[model samples]
Target: MTRFARTVAAVALTTALALTAGCGGSDSDADAGSDGKALKKVTYLTSFGNFGRDAYAWVAKDKGFFKDAGFDVTIRPGQGTGGVIPAIVGGQAQFGPIDLTGGLLNMGNGQAKDFVAVAAVQQHTMAAIATTEGNGISKPKDLEGKRLADTPGSVVRNLFPTYARLAGVDATKVKWVNGEAQTLMGTLAGGSVDGIGQFVVGKPTVEAVTKKKAVLLPYSAVIPDLYGNVLITSKKNAENDPESVRRFTAALLKGLEYSLGHTQEAAQILKRNVDTTNPAAAAAELELMAGYVTPKDGSGAVIGSLDSGRVAKSIRLLEDAGTLPKGMTPDQIIDFDLVPKG
Candidate 1:
């Protein structure tokens, strides 16, 4: 999913596809500001099709945070960060939900304009390998000498082999098979492939539908701590339209807090927003996402909290591992100016 998260299609404006109706508070909650004016509208583009961000959107609308913040917010789902950055830069949308790394890579390659992470939606990585039961694949190393399906350039497909290497498996031994998300689950259930990287949220759903237990290998358990989905916007947008971004971020974080606090209700809302074949599965996945939603208590709950030191560490790791180009600084990969210190 992270690979799909990374290689998502380029951002563009389209007919406003309202997945669920937006919820707002009463007139009192929408009380006028100093000038007694209404809120401004901010359009946001999401980075993936089944990304499951409806939780945040719904919570915000139902909670009146956006109305209080003076924003008429509209959310559009993008296939990947590729599509998101362009849309924001083109002013087709105000900001977008994107992978922080993918957004930075786009900026570094000059494929997109500079942007800031207004808030971190899911700090921990969520992609993982879900395997069929009775395959005797108990651990990460068991994936060796098996077929794994994935699209090329997917974060999971591209990184799994490396992750296997770290887990003491000869990544070359595993056969790479090309397949789509639908086919991957089918293949795994049908015994065509041993396993494939999938979102952990989808694992339980797959098990319920396929009647098979899947072992989800959390990447955080194997590799360096990495940031996942985030609220992103152009540097110009952030600097010139700070109020809009602030309103958007506040509403989004409020949504996150609500979703985290109320999973069962949130899951019901999520099932309605996601692909419909697996409502129970979607509900289960939304529950799984709570891990990504709320950071540990010791860890502050800054929506877009960033650590320059950690980023520098990742740069060194990627450079050493040949994943990132040399001489890339954290500043080149991150724009912390937009995210205020909590």
Candidate 2:
């Protein structure tokens, strides 16, 4: 098995019995953690693996943010929407990050998350179809007859029909193949695919691997109202154990804010935890990601905050694209009372 699979399996095997991660108890009812504190024990999953983009979780654990929040968090690498959503809903993890738009699409497709979304991870959508210079794809129109690759349930691919309509590209003319998250950049580098579904901030990692300038057709350029990653937990957890949700969200946002501010140190921290990590590459990713994570709506909303109007617009866009069912509201996906307020 791949390291990610093996890691996830090992965690599932070990913690499945020990963890009461879902909405099984009250805030005061908890278990003893490693630090000898009666902190609630929960497993958390990052949307992707241990890339710099996901370092905030490790930061929360490393900097004692999780501990201070009165919890023992076991951080695990997730395999995108397909992998993470089921894990959170089925009780393997108590919290996780997911692309907000992708979650909506999943809900529309009849895959219920059992009521999720607690906070926003980024203020904007960073989904994009990225390619190298020599691939001859410079614009949306250029993507016609070109090949693309991404994991099966990636938002970049799931939301493509809407993006294509907005950008005036012929969505059906483009080709797609399945790829693992860890190998998408490699496929692009090897010229096996013209482009890969990637986040805008992934340019640094992509460029470093392909040794070429990365060209991007960012989904946000057309689908502006969509939020990026959003924090999610089971409905029972949010409704019954709200204090735990609130504390965990606060500590996680603290880590995300700190990681972005201290990019180099955050990268070093990731490297320290994951021996294969390259500090420079990780730092570069955080630097590019900073702008997206920053609130550009001029509403002065802090990090991890959500906006209602923007979310409604995203839903309308999805409905127009026929990927989403009608009457889907933001409240069904986001727990506004738990997110940061402006």
Candidate 3:
């Protein structure tokens, strides 16, 4: 197995053991709901830290959406998108918010056959080429011949070729400088590298470090069909407890819609559960992310629903980028039936 695969396997094994130990008792031992009945215990794993990226899940828990759905949900922080699939497959988490590309690539590579996305949270690629204001890297083409801080396992770096193809640029000309996420923005600001392939969501991190606004060249600007975070589960979960999955999806979508309409309130709610050291920064990030939850294609405002056409396009893009095999189709990676309808 590759290093990434090995790391995921290790993390999944640890997570599964920890989770099993946490729920050693019977179902009746689970936390009681508002009705005094034992709520079904379920665990959720996120792709990253609680940096307002998972505001919806936080909001849902704080607002009692999961409780209303008869589930006592335990949210756990994940290592990354690469680890989330393994967490779910190994029965550590019943549901996970993961990167759609990573999930699809795993399916295409035959690493994960039972994993499928029930809901797409972000409608576009959150990855971008972030640079300082005066870096002279205004567009994708400008990245050619420039030194870019390439963080290990970054989705942006993995999909840089697809972005380059869409923007009509030669990705080979760009000089990649290996770095870590903690130091990428600092390195770029200190002139060690021209830019960094990062997520637009990290704008706050960059601004906090450099005390200057970061210029983001979003991958979605070039590849409009790309997707970001998604709600994924194993086929076994869907088959065994369809109602639980439905309730979870409905509650999550409700939380997403609530967050979109009440950004400040959502941030406050998120503060109660997650780390919001800078409330203003968290609120700002949530506001920017709200647009991602809104569908750009005039589809209904319901969150967590997949756009089949967009998924089809994304499949083709992944295939062309060599992430997915040529014969892989959307049906293998996505399960639209689990998304609750109005």
RMSD of each: 5.8, 6.9, 7.4
User: Model 2 — which ten-residue stretch has the worst lDDT?
Assistant: 1-10
lDDT of each: 0.60, 0.77, 0.68
lDDT tens digits by residue: candidate 3, 215-296? 8888888887778878988889988888778888888778777776766776676555543234555566666776676665
In candidate 3, how many clashes are counted?
Answer: 0
Residue runs of model 3 more than 4 Å from their true location after superposition: 1-30, 147-151, 175-193, 296-298
lDDT of 1 by residue, 118-230 (tens): 77767666656777677767788888777887644345665564467667878888888876433456666677777775655656655764577767776667774766777
* Better candidate by lDDT, 1 or 3: 3
Error of 3 at 109 (Å): 2.8
TM-scores for candidates 1 onward, in order? 0.77, 0.88, 0.82
Q: Rank the candidates by TM-score, best first.
A: 2, 3, 1
Give per-residue CA lDDT, model 2, range 53-156, as digits (tens).
Answer: 87777777777777778887777777787778888889989999989999999987787668678888877888888888988888899999999998898888
Which candidate number has the best lDDT? 2
